[model samples]
Target: MDLNQIRNDFPTLQEEVNGKRLAYFDSGASALKPRVVMDRLAQFYEKEYSNVHRGVHYLSQVSTLAFEDVRGKVQTFLNAAREDEIIFTAGTTESINLIAYSYVLPYLGKSDAILISEMEHHSNIVPWQLIAKMNGMDIKVVPVLDNGALDMQAFDNLLTPDVKFVSITHVSNTLGTVNPVKEIIEKAHANGSKVLVDGAQAAPHMTVDMQELGCDFYVFSAHKVFGPTGVGVLYGKFEVLDQVKPWQGGGDMIETVSFEGTTFNVLPHRLEAGTPNIAGVIGFGEALDYLAKIDVNWRYQHELNLLDYAMKGLKEFPQVRVLGTVPGKAAVICFVIDGVHAHDVGSLMDMNGVSVRVGHHCTEPLMKRFKVPATARASISFYNNKEDIDQWLSVFPKIFKFFG
Candidate 1:
């Protein structure tokens, strides 16, 4: 897949950190932006900077066209049925919250329950807890097995008629376990429940088709997928999203406003309030364009190869215990070394110019379930190669020596 060319696209990889070459293994938190995306952002701000959707002036019109064109790009990215079904928000957290407040809270009754998993990020879990508490609704959790895969039998048992909605992560940020979201969506639909899939981890690694998955809602952050931060997507089915009320009231989200009353705009804009992230959205379109040039299957297989190589290396160290050993998981390794704190391991790795994420990763519940206070995670991307994994693994000996 032209690995050298791919690495060259990210200028950060060329830089040195602490006199060592940077082995960036933190793609799950946020991916390194490509040169094209950054250049596009600069171009937009320099020449076409203006507030979208109002002015008839040339810059505003240009800005508006460029910004809205991204919505179409996202629609194509997810293979959604309609462009209007895609809503822009701050990030995945905001997207989930918007659904909780705008759709689920208004439609579902107090007695209805929402189902989630132990592996969900805090973004997926907390919003439901907040709304459920306020509305006197119940939240059900599906258990994770010892191997970090979901207990599908338990999921089936929990899919009772009382569950009005289900929210699950497509790929776990901590465990790297790819949940069977398509199957889960089908089951939930059969049982008369809608579903939302958090694709923050999955979208960067794989392709997600809306018509194929048939999820009521799907969300992912642009930064995690080689785009800019402060912008993300919420893909909802048109029939379902059209029925939900607007979560916020402000400038562009309205059809009309008077002292008497105010009416809202159509599908996508109805949900996006105020001045949207114009530059970020335009850059995100460039990111999608960048991704389209690559083959999806090749990317997936390359990441799996990286995962296997890293796992094999980690297995050689008796002190290292890797979490989430399920087959076909994403290219993320969350491991804890014996007798060393995760933060210490992270610091040591950083000194070696091998970046990794350490802590609960906003999945405190998953950490508690796994009986670990925290873990050090190295998440991979298509741009990473065996040399990066070698650098990551080379730090283990130093870690063990320091702890001993």
Candidate 2:
């Protein structure tokens, strides 16, 4: 990938943060939007600004077409079996909550269990906890090994007929571990349990094939994948989505409304209850187009190359301790500088034009499991390169002096 060409597409990459040239390394939290995505959002509101699927006028027709076009692009992107299986939501958190409330709450009971990993983001963890509590179902946790890979042996023991559902994050946002989701899905299915994969981290950094993974549900946010915020994708198997009741009620999601009873609309419309984020959805489609035009393999390799450079530099820091370096890890390096809190290291890095995430990253349970209060995370994307890692390496050593 051409770093100069890619950098030109993201205007924010050149901006100064904290009075220093920005070196953003927080792609895992939320990626920076490309010029195409930004321009698409602007053009959408400027040209086709109207409520979709309700009015019969020209503006509505244009708006509705733009909105549904995103659904088609997303369906193709994930290789979903059908367009009706894709439902849009606010973001990853909302998408997961939708699945939990719509499917898990209604189907699971006292004898059922929801299995998850200790390394999951809060989006993947708390939703199941809430549904399990509401339905009197048990929440089972699969352990993480020392290298931050999910304990496959422990996972095998946990997969039993009692497991009603298994929800696993496709990548650990904190650990950068790429999970073995296809195998996990197959095992879960054998035990008669449905599966959900949170692709919030996976879709942005790597290609995702929903049909091949064969999970019951797969969810991800648009913003994390270089699109606009307030839009997310939730892909479910047709039969599973058919059985789920709509969580929210109102607007175009109804066939007949009455004071006594209301008949809901079809599968996807049943779940999408309200006027959706039309502009954001349109921008999401543009983002997908932008991604498709680029060579994704080259992008992945670029990110991995930067990760390798950063990892090598970080290992040389006498005080630094790198977190999970699993064999099949993605583009993330979460670590803690010795004798200094992660927050302090982040502050020091900022003074030198570096930006990194420093906190629990919404995985409080995983942080506790790792026995660290928090960690400083440097997550790279295609826009980043050896120069960015070199800049970080040049600045990071001062953290010890700044705190000493």
Q: Tens-digit lDDT track for model 2 on 169-207?
A: 999999999999999999999999999999999999788
TM-score of every candidate relative to the true structure? 0.99, 0.98
Candidate 2 global TM-score: 0.98
lDDT of 1 by residue, 24-114 (tens): 9999999999999999999999999999998999999999999999999999999999999999999999999999998889887788999
In candidate 1, residue 98 scores what lDDT? 93
Count backbone clashes in candidate 2: 0
TM-score of 1: 0.99
What shift in Å separates residue 275 of candidate 1 from its native position after superposition? 0.6
- In candidate 2, which residue pairs get closer than 3 Å at backbone N, Cα or C atoms, i.e. clash? none
Residue 324, model 1: lDDT of 91
Regions more than 4 Å wrong, model 2: none
